[model samples]
Target: MPSLWHSIPALLLLPASISAVTLDCKHIRVDKQSFDLSALGGPKTVHQLQYLQPSISNTTFTIDICQSLKRTKGVPKSDECAGGTRVCGIERIYNQADDSSTTERVIPIAGEFSTSHGRAMDPEVTRLKDSASNSDSELEGLRVELHGGKWPETSGGSLQKAIIEFQCARDVTGNEGFEDAAEGSMLDIKSYGNLTRRAGEDAQEDDDNDDDEDGPPELPDLDKGKSLQFVSYKPDSDGVGVLRLNWKTKYACEGAYDEPPSGGGSNKTAHWGFFTWFLIVTFMLAATYIIFGSWLNYNRYGARGWDLVPHGDAIRDIPYVVKEWTGGVVDKLKGSGGSRGGYSAV
Candidate 1:
């Protein structure tokens, strides 16, 4: 005879399945990370990364990806980062030197990257192959269309699931200290080439033209409250591959952000500022009335000025009383006052 609440946990533990299509994507954090490199004799280039914050429309990320390449087989290094693709999008990368020096740059956003291979002047990566050896490589930009919602507008966004596809590739080096150790390194790369849906409208839509349903829905805007699932990953074993990433970038504005405590950092006495000013003004006004009233009565009413005023009778006799008291003191001091018998200075 357990209550309904007691059965809730049991039901939740029961094996359940969902048919919703979930997108898988490599979770590229919004921070600086180790830059990716290509095979041996790869161009000496710099790569950039950046993300479009919900508040910003454009951003810039500058980096100096520095690695010293050595001459192999008595051959001078010819091209730097010559045969590789540098993926830059929707993020920023920071390369900070130990001297407290930092380089910042913005990466490309959605649909903005160079798939072309081995051009000397790739916008994403700067090539200084011909420059002096040990010269720092500067990554100027990885420009692309930014996707994100605005603050306050995108706040409390709804959670959504997206099928993201990404390819993870890293440079693997065998010789720890060869002439071109970093470049000659070979690592088995994973690629996510095939994208599968739940066989719904997203999978059936073939025409990229004006159709009710396009291929897969665009990525959800990057938000703190949104959910992203990388649908799959494919690795490339031999040839170099592009590390493409799709994220949840179109979140519905429905989830609630952790609002600061309703009355946090607020002082209960904040209104005291106004209250203090009010008291000062009231006191000043009262003082003013008192001072001005005395002046007016003296000037306008002459001898009868204080006659009608509060406690005016006692105040009016102040001069006469002071004079009488003064004379009495003088007479007593002289030992001539009435009923004073002692005249000797004892």
Candidate 2:
């Protein structure tokens, strides 16, 4: 007879073979741009800008803005931008004349790009709106134009880079409440390409379709007296299925299918059995400790010991000397038995 441990190798091999599915991936990247609005006669306000990708559903992109410096103890630092809570659309003029001198805002730029499919494929672009919105909040939008081109073929090589450009306006309100505007150019670009050939492609291509039907009719024999039978099935040289044999073996081994077998009752039962035994063992140990402690305590102080000294009858009849030394001595001692042994005055 074989031990249950003998089946572990087969069990391990099954999952490894089943988990070997291949996947395809696409790569994308975005670059950061900086813009200064102070050139428009407004307080030199700095804007943190990011271009956003479009959503799969929507083809529009968006720009988010926020105060760059947060006010700390009323002191403005060079690196700090204006801090406030408000998310206005990109069209809304940021940096209006407020009480504060130093100001900053976060802005997003969004538009669409075309994909290789000749159909529009918009990537999601995300940005942070102005400060009044949560400091960590991000504004998301889609590209304005659909990505043009077929999914770039990766057979030759990975995509190198793609570029796009647009125009942006920076409008600032001065201390006198006069607004000034400056137009600057915005450029957005991304690069793609890093492709590998799919695995198992050659094997799939070489399968013999004509001989598939004329091949042996594979069937399991019920007449085979079952001790523990191991079935070994292997994919053909072309990565196809071929039944080898059902042999009498000490361990019955099977491999994992593309999908896992659904009967999980045994696993649940084993978990419950483990928990039940754990609780039983825990309670038994606790009870054993409690009983052992009670037994030890009873054996210690609860057991009586023998008296070492014996009292004679004559000694018992005689009056105690401590009793005779009473009155004056007792009074001087304040009736505390004069610190004598045995007799105590109450």
Candidate 3:
């Protein structure tokens, strides 16, 4: 009974350690369905063309973050984030619903920015402290790049078009789901302040360029949270950082192959099949002629083995013709052998 009494205090302390933290934030969505390589009206297949099903990995999310004029400790400041209330840090909070719980430190703003096309213009979705992504899973980087967004020491976008690559196993492989690298495939992103407008006429269409020398372009970063302009940064008003991601996926819908058979190979096979038969017939005809000639010689002329068919009459007549030309009828009557012994009296 005394030991059971000691456990009462320990059970009561559990609730105090794990407190429920409700995050006051907004969600900015960067949808993927809008940016499709095929819909852009160009040569769709490139970079070896390995597509995936229209599932989770096919899409990416981005959010622009802005910092307020009021300085938040550890949050960096930038020219684009000047004079307004903006987002300071991006914190990924975890609650007690899964196997484990973790609250990652807020991703600090780097003050770097890149310009890209935008579509949505929901003020309610943008002006909050929280953000949503294309994926709920945590991914390290882009599959095509084998890595994710980078925080370089400059502010600009790569002029080269980015590629969105799909990741799926071979047809023979049993694994069908994209959940393995799903975490590393997702984009945990932040960007400049909220978007003020939807995609406009000035928005540039996705560039279409498959380099003749180099390979295809890379997929744009989903978490490339570009800083935004702000009127002022106060207690509530913060600068915005916009996230823009470009992902291209390649996948088969139903019956397809990695390397479809080409006409060149097919054409070669067709021609080769015909010529092989032609050669066989030619060889057979030649053999038949030689065999028949030997048979005729053996049966009609009693020729020995390996002897050519008789055509000796033509050779014997040649000398007769020559003798007749030189000695007239006297030599011609005895054929080519006439008077050959000793200039015979005849």
Task: Report lDDT (CA) for all predictions.
Answer: 0.27, 0.25, 0.28
C-alpha lDDT (0 to 100) for residue 115 of candidate 3: 22
Predicted structure 3: lDDT: 0.28
Off by over 4 Å in 1: 3-5, 9-346
In the range 19-100, model 1's lDDT, one tens digit per residue, is 1101111111112321121111221212221222111121121111121122235432231111221222122222221212
lDDT of 3 by residue, 1-346 (tens): 2343354365445444323111111111222111111111211111111111110112212122222224434645542222221222222322212312222322222221222222112122121112245551232112211111222223552111122222222232211222233422222322110110111111212223332453222323332321111121112122233232232222211111223333333323334445866886676565455556656776787776335434546646889888777787665676765556667664
- Indicate the residue-level lDDT of 346 in model 1: 61
Measured by lDDT, the strongest candidate is 3
Local lDDT at 295 for model 3: 60
lDDT of 2 by residue, 49-139 (tens): 2111110010111111112122335543332222221111111111112311122322111111222112222332222232245632332
State the TM-score for model 3.
Answer: 0.16
Clashes of 1: 58
| Runs in model 2 lying further than 4 Å from the true structure | 1-266, 303-346
Alpha-carbon deviation at 184 in model 1, angstroms: 18
In the order shown, the candidates' Cα RMSDs to the true structure are: 30.7, 35.1, 33.2
Global Cα lDDT for candidate 1: 0.27
Better of 1 and 2 by lDDT: 1
